[model samples]
Target: MRMLRQLLYRLIISLRTFRKKGLRAGFAELGRTISRIFYQRAEFIVIARALLEQIPPAASKQGLVIRRATTREEIASLSPIADMIDMARFHKMFDHGSFAFIAFQNDQPVGYCWVSEEVDRNVTRVQPPLHPGDACVHDLFVSPAHRGRRIGRALVSHRLRFLREHGYKRALAVVRRDNVPALKVDKKTGYTNIGEMSHTRILFWDSFRYNIPDA
Candidate 1:
């Protein structure tokens, strides 16, 4: 009787352990499957407008106001605070770079875009150096609720004109293949593709290489 009881206890414990392991494994696989499905396609349209004469509202039809960001505070207003590293680093870049354009509606910042320039330099080695005369589009974002009304396009168009006036021969922006909206925007904007899609293995606190795909 004693022997039977001991065996029964061990069997119960073994069964519980097996069940727990199976649950964990299933969840892990489910997470991977979900990620795979999400990344399988592009997301977001990156439209380019000629120039915004007015600020577009989140709901009611209102004009969008677009202009160059002259101060860190101005840039901060446009930033979504999605990542502190991006915010801090861009502030630093603003000091070093030339133009940082921002868009607003009713005096409230709606979107922002910037271009980094190296006029005479042959190339910039960022992890893997970018070619000389290539002006990189640093930041481009429209508020989640305020997108689809050409706000992003206007900001980008304004920046492009600024870059052209400043003598930038070409512009470059790295987009994740999964960003469908951005891809569409680029296509409509007359910005051609140039490849340099190598991942930087280095990680930093609050550093985001690209925006996560919106579901």
Candidate 2:
């Protein structure tokens, strides 16, 4: 029943996207949404501050400069690379005390990530709320032109170091279970599986969420 409902929802969304953005963009978006719903589940991972090893030499040699985004203007600058809606959300996250990092390659923004000591209610609502010393890393993205160069790994390493320096004891990251590349990167960077989460929405109305222990 749930699977059928999800398929129906995807159909509706794809039709809507097709109407708004044309066939190619619509199908692309639909493919991504359906892939996540059917093939991916969310996994929560934890990495202790003390266990965060040094950033790899490859990451260091990439000549990427990373810095925290501090103002609306800085957040707005991400528009060239990020969707406007996403930049707006990041601005809101900044207002809520979340730390945002931007990575630059030769003076152009190539990637970014966000870290927060508390969950953004606008985002996912985690059960067993975040502890005082826990930091959540979210919205990690690297430009397609710069991928496969260890840029994502470098972003995670830099965030871990930032959290450690700021007195956070552990860092938390959530990734889709079937995202082999992301999962491999997380494990290579020392994140350990801690739990799994799932969400179900009905008719754009009431929603249900489940948090399960990691086996």
Q: TM-score for each prediction?
A: 0.58, 0.73
The numbered model that scores best in lDDT is 2
- How much lDDT does candidate 1 score? 0.54
After superposition, which runs of candidate 2 have C-alpha atoms over 4 Å from their true positions?
Answer: 1-58, 123-128, 204-215
- Those runs of model 1 whose alpha carbons end farther than 4 Å from true positions after fitting are 1-62, 79-83, 118-132, 202-215
What is the Cα root-mean-square deviation between model 2 and the actual structure? Answer: 6.0
Residue 99: error of model 2 in Å?
1.4
Positional deviation of residue 43's Cα in model 2 after best superposition, in angstroms: 7.1
lDDT of 1 by residue, 1-215 (tens): 32234334444444554577786665664554444332433222222222223323223236787778787777677555334435645666766764577777778777777666642121222321235555667457777777888877777666776766666656666566576676666666675543334333221212223332310
lDDT of each: 0.54, 0.68
Backbone clashes, candidate 2: 0
